[model samples]
Structure formats: structure tokens, C-alpha cells
Target: MYTLSLEVVNKCNLNCSYCYLGEKKNTSMSIDTAKKAIEIAVHEVQKQYDKTLVIYFIGGEPLIAFNVIYEIVAYTKSRCMEMNLKYMFSITTNGTLLTKKIIDFFIKDKFEIKLSLDGSQEVHDLNRKDYQNVGSFLTIINKLKLLRKYEKESDKKVSYAHVVTKNNYQHFEKNFQFLIDLGAERVETGIDYYCTWNNDEMKGLGIQIVNVFALYKNQVQIEKKRIYWNLLEHYLEMYLTTCNFYACKAGLNSMFVAVNGKIYTCIELPEFQIGSIMEGLNIQRIREIAYVEDKLSESCINCKYKSICKTRGCQASNYEIHRNIYEPVEVKCRMTKVFLNLIENNFTSQQLENLKIREDR
Candidate 1:
């Protein structure tokens, strides 16, 4: 699988406090640039003989560049069909700009939609605010209600991507329950790696995770109900597979194309530019990013949980925190150890063995 993430626009209507983009620029992707990016991405996938191509639209707000998105999707579909390549499309949005027309288009095209929300109205309003400093919770919730209505009439499932922060860490269960109440069955949430966490906050987060895990075990293992919690699912998969590597597919089979045509290994790491759509990929830079795992810290190499640990850590976060991709974030490392211990303590040896057998098959 090859994923091509396009940054459709560099402008946003919201001034989210934890936004990685920092300052907003008044820039949007031109149709010409979009076409070239699509061509370059398609050629790369074809050259690599990838079976699947995923066109992922992202931005400060992708919906802000809806016209450009429409053009690219239409063009990419035709191009992929002509080349006999299988393709899938997806978009990550803030959910503030969702409209009936946009919802209809996504449903018709079967585009995977991920909406950014921070659970309850109060927690969401703490950071996610509009340009005028107004809370966006009500606006987003209203839009989400409309989306849920359309989703029931179509085959599409809208998933939520939540950001957990120190402000809401103590209320994790409450936040999660709020999303469930808002008609979200599939929820993807992660701690803000960039935020500083106090000891109390970390402990609270651990307790919350454990509570959620217990709930997940009861529902899935006991009641046999189908629900998706990304964090719980990831740890469960790691336990079942016993996989050694946990690196993200950023530079390996995925890339981010900026609005101005510059390319990077991942969208969050704009400083690590690999090339541009106009000049094509920089082979040496790509190779360096692909082999970044080889430059691991000695601590990681000697850690007891190195083998079974599925937390290879995000290179972008590592670079931002430690100024080196190989240097693991101490907080994340500690959290991983705690999480693994929790798993070891919760499940019996026989249950784990059964899971392995089932997964391995």
C-alpha cells in the first residue's frame, strides 16, 4: 500500500491551540499543482508495483480547498482507472465546514472520513476555537448530527480522531463516553505528544486507559460486541502478533505533498523535505528516511521490552522533542512500559496464547 497525503490548503478558519502548523499562511493548492502531484504519486506507485494507492486529503482545513479537492479526485479516479491501478480516497477534516453537498459527495465516492473532535463540548472548547476565539464545539456537533443522519442512509461510516491533552487526561472515560453518546462507534484518540504532562496527569491517563481496556475486554471478549477503540485495538494486536517492528509507514510507502508542491516523509515534519512535485523525489533523502530505524538510541536497543514493544515512537515527535529522530521521547517510553505491564497483568498466559494462535493463522 502507498499513501499520498495532499495538503490541500495552508489556511484554516480555526486557531486550534495545539495545532502543529503554528502560524497560518494564506495559501491554497492550485489545480495545476494538484494535477502534477497526482501524476507524480501515481507514477511512483506504478514504479514500485504497489497493489493499493490511497489518496489522503489533509490540510489546515481541506474543506477550505473543496474546489481543488473536487478536481483532483475526479482527475485521479480517471488516471488510476486508465492505468488499471486500484485506489482509495480519504479525508481528515475539522468537521466545522461539512455541508450537505460535501457529505453527499463523500458518501457517493465512498471516501473514508475522519473528523477531529475532542469529546465533550467543554473539553473541545478548551482548545479548538474559531479564528475569532469562539468555541467550535456547537458548530461541529451540529455538523456531525447532519453527517450521522446521512451516514445512516449510506454505506459510509464516519470515524472520530480525538486529541487527548493534559486538560482532558483526567476525564478520559467521560470524554470517551461523550463521543459514544454522539453516535461514534469507531474512535481514534492519542495523547498530544507535544504537550508537557505532569506526574499526576500521567497517572490519571494510565488509570483511564486501564479502565477503557477493562471495558473493551468485557464488551469484546465477554459480550462479543463489535466496537473500535484505536489504542486498545493496537495493544491487542501487538499482544496477538508478537510483531517486532512498530515503525510508521511514513517514508517507506507513504509521503506528504504540501500545497506549494514540496514533499516530505510525513506531513508533520515539514523541515525534512524529500523533494518536490516539480523536481521529483530525492532518492538519497528518501533512502535516509526509510532507514531511520537503524539509527536507534542505545537505550532503546538495550530496553527489556524492545522486542515485544509495538511503540517504535513517531519520528516527527522525536525530532520535535529531542532534535533527533533516533532519540526516543522519555515520556512515551515510560508510557509504553506501563501499557505493556498492564497488558501482562490483565490477561492470562492461556488467553494470550489462544490470541496468538488465532492471529497467527
Candidate 2:
């Protein structure tokens, strides 16, 4: 479950409206810094007795710094082999820069590719526009077509990183169906916490989730499609485990390495530097990040749904808006309550029991 996210470059070709990184720098991670990052990351995972290490490529668009990724993968493979560890590589791209050579490399390496596509063209173009303010839907969908052709050649399946914004929340159903039709094996839809949300918009989004999950339920029950959606997975996990798992595991199970070689718990929280590749992780800061939830505001801790709530919000998001991770995002807390309540009202008790039985089987 441990992940090392490398912000390969601080540059991106697109100027998406809701980019959480705020501003992009022209910096890229030097091979030396990357190697040092690998060394420390491998050491951390090993010390914990974990056999797997997920070396994730993230950025202003990781493909822009693809050469760094190529070199890092080679070095990591060597180190992992020596340590008798299993290594995984994954990248999230905007899908405007696919080429045969790149696709070939991805296939050969068995990369877990996630395309940062927001859904249908109209809805996508709303925010995910290139520097020229042109919609990137056509470019991405075309690239996706090429990727899918390669997908048939191997067992690798493509997943999507869907971003929901206040502007596009209403179109989520259509956008999600479009991706499903385009043969997405998995979709991890996350809200655009960079933007502000009004109470009405938040409620509308909750309604969208309830409606979408109804479709999701039908797909699971009637068609038996094996597609995975993150929200549904979280809901099911909450039901089965009765554990209020937080939305993010940054400080506890993950670390994000920025292009400057500084380490943070997440890409969004640039200010929360836990350490650097040169200095190594600050155990105290990491431990504080791991336990940030327990130190939430008194109101959040004593909320009626605190024990069952799944939307404790992300540390990065909380810090981005509130300048403090412990201060919960009102919209996130409210949406969690609304979505779960709407879901409870939507599904019959027998259906819930049936879902539990089916999931267990």
C-alpha cells in the first residue's frame, strides 16, 4: 500500500483550469535526485518489511519528462531485483502525448496507465483545455484509441482519473457512461477541491453520486460488468469493514517527491514539507501527518456521523482551503453525510444485505 509519487517535471503542456499545483515551474527532476529518491524510498519500504514498492510518476504531466521516468525505471528495477522486492510503475497522463514508442515502452514495462480525462468532449473541454484554450477531448480520445489498440495486445487495462468540478458535476453521469462505453476498466473520480463549492452545488453533487451509483448498481447486477469505480468501492468497503477509512493515506502510506527533491505527503500541499531526498523523511512530521485526523476540530470529532463518515476530506485539500489539515472542509463533510443519507434512502435494506452477501462471495 506504500506509494512513492515523483513529480517528474513542474511543467505541463496544458493549462487546465482546476490544476491543484496552482503554478507550474519549468524545473525537472535531475537523474541524480531521482536516483537518491529511489534509494530512500526502497529503504523505507524494506525497513517496514513490505515486499512491494509502487514508484508512481506524477507531475505537471509526467510524459513531458518521460526520459527521467525511463532512467528511473531502469535504476529501480536493478535496485528492486537486488533487494528481492516487487516493483510497480504507474503514470497519470493527460493523454495528449501518446506515441507508438511511448505506448510500446508502457506495454513492455507493464505500466499501470491512468489517463487524466474528465469524460465527454463537451464536458471535458469545459476545464481541461490546452494552453491555447482549445478543448483536448479530441486529442485525448484519439490517443486513447491508440492505447486501447495496444491494450488488446496485452492484459494491461487502462483506467481513468476523472475530475469533478462544480461546473461539470451535473454532467458526471453522462461523462462516466461515456468512459465506460470507451472501454475504461476502472475510473477513479475525485472532486476538484481546488475550486470552491456552494451548498447547492455540493448537494447537487451528492445527488449526482446517488444517481450514478444507481446506474453502477445496475451495471453490477444486471450486466455483471467488472468495471471498477472508486466511490462505489469506498462505499462497499465502508459497509463491509465498518471502518471509517480516511480519503487519503499520504503521510501514513504514501509520499510525494516534488521536482525540487523535497518530500511532502501529497502533491497539493507544497508547504507541508516533511523532509527532502538529501535529508530523508522527518519521522516526527510523518507521524503527525499519519495521525492528523485524530487531531481534527472538536465539532468534527463529535459529529453525529464521525464514526461512519467516509469523507474526512484530504489533508492536502483541507490545507489548501483552510490552511490547516485538522480543520475539516465543510462541503466535504456535508457531502459525505448527504451522499450516504441519499444512498440509504435509495437502497432497500434487503438490497444492502444482498450486496454484502454478494461482495463476500
lDDT of 2: 0.81
Residue 179: error of model 1 in Å? Answer: 1.2
TM-scores for candidates 1 onward, in order: 0.91, 0.90
Model-by-model lDDT, in order?
Answer: 0.80, 0.81
Compared with the true structure, what per-residue lDDT tens digits does model 1 show for residues 249-294?
A: 5766788888888988885566578888899888888776666554
Candidate 1 clashes between residue pairs 3 or more apart in a chain or in different chains: none
Tens digit per residue, CA lDDT, model 2, 1-361: 4689999998989999998777787789999999998888888787555678899998898999999999999999999999889889999999888898899888888898888889888898999998888989888877866788668765878888889998899998888888888888798998876577987898888888877887777777898888898876666655544543445656666788889899988764556778899999898987766665455476587777667665554666667788876667877777667656655777788878888787776
Find the 10 residues in a row with the least total lDDT in model 2: 238-247
Model 1 error, position 123 (Å): 1.0
